[model samples]
Target: MSGTPATALDFPGEVVTQAHVRYVALPGVAGPLALVTLDNGLDHTRPSTFGPAGLRSLLAAADEIEAHTPAVSAVAVTGKPFIFSVGADLAFRSSLRDPEAARAGIHAIGELGHAALRRIGEGHFGGRKVPTFALVNGAAMGGGLEVALHCDYRALSSDVTALALPEVFLGLLPGWGGTQLLPNLVGADRAVTIAIENPLNQNRMLRAAQAFALGLADVLLEPADFLEEALRWAARVIRGEIDPAAARAPVRRGAVWA
Candidate 1:
């Protein structure tokens, strides 16, 4: 896949959006899996935030992964150490002056994010429908959580400190499929708590344990070898060694109290 031109969009700050891809072969697994890591050059302090250029970069990476020869059996997306992503680049939005310009910019951002996420959700890479997973290693709020929700399955690290849809606190909503996908995954009441009620109540964030109880994560692993564990879990699911229904049954009861 061709890279997005540098002139395509002017992003704020020195954010260098990039996707690092690698293939991993799991024991007893039939085929190699594609693993994509999202990064923004900055350390965990900056957190990966999506802007127009950043979204385009992700799209390019997805395209490239889809075109891989021999066809991967599945795909997994993860983030840098101690961070999944904070969400959209609010700094970029803060730069707009005119209302019309701001509206158009916001619309464009939502469209780009949705399109790329939809492709991942449907596993529509290179004319195939492979299973997709999200390994949320740390904080994942707003658009970041939406990205995770788009995946077929998600795993979380016990070290994760924050998870929520805080757009409502900022006088906005999760316009990038969060409202729809969240309710479908975790039920309407909990979706309201995470996307609305909690945001209104000082933007409360869910700890990793809370998220697991809410059924947002299929598996929770210790930070030590978190990715390796998540990869193994994905392979087990793909190979029919683990039952997704059984895995979710225990969490479904926990969501009642979450």
Candidate 2:
């Protein structure tokens, strides 16, 4: 139809997801902790979704943080009030008419997402590789879950009721690193269960406890003080008070994975 809408901003009327960065002073953490908040400039009703424009916004935010003066010791990403993100904007997917156009759009979005999110894990900022944490404080689905997987560590909120990778159910694969990252984080079998099995079986989603048990997150905190607790937990991890490897021992051990 419309030549397969160009950028995620192709839809003139759609709201653009914005990545906002701010430095938070952690009590024990040495340098400033750069916190990136994803918001579509909307209320909780509209969960943030990454489109090309959104992905570009995120990259710019990372650029800003990396260029800061004093340099940051750690980096963390989180969502708005009640939502982290639901993944790629389905509106972009639904608008494509031509198969070739859809293919091109998907490729463009995938590349942008990879370039934007991978920096967190690569730890390329402030002349050294600082640690990264995904502070998942609310609902996260599809690409949202994948974004968390990009972080070196994930801190989830106990009140999160919906967490999933439902791409297969949506007639798409988890192209934006979910397929690879999920398997590596939780092992192959469990990754199959999450990335394929659950999506096939009625698009089942994971609750906070279920995801925590599955080893998707490093720690889970109460919702009442979710952000604060997540920050504190991140500080502990950065300060070496908490060992992520030890936290994931149960998952890495042969019992559950086997």
Provide the overall lDDT of each model, using Cα atoms, as 2-decimal numbers. Answer: 0.82, 0.84
**Model 1: how far is 59 from its true place, Å?**
0.4
Each model's TM-score?
Answer: 0.91, 0.91
- Candidate 2: where are CA atoms >4 Å away? 1-9, 250-258
Q: Report the poorest 10 consecutive residues by lDDT, candidate 2.
A: 1-10
**Index of the highest-lDDT prediction:** 2
Query: Candidate 1, clashing residue pairs?
Result: none
User: Clashes in each model (backbone N, CA, C under 3 Å)?
Assistant: 0, 0
Residue 103 lDDT (model 2): 85
Candidate 1 lands at a TM-score of: 0.91
Find the candidate with the highest TM-score and give its number: 2
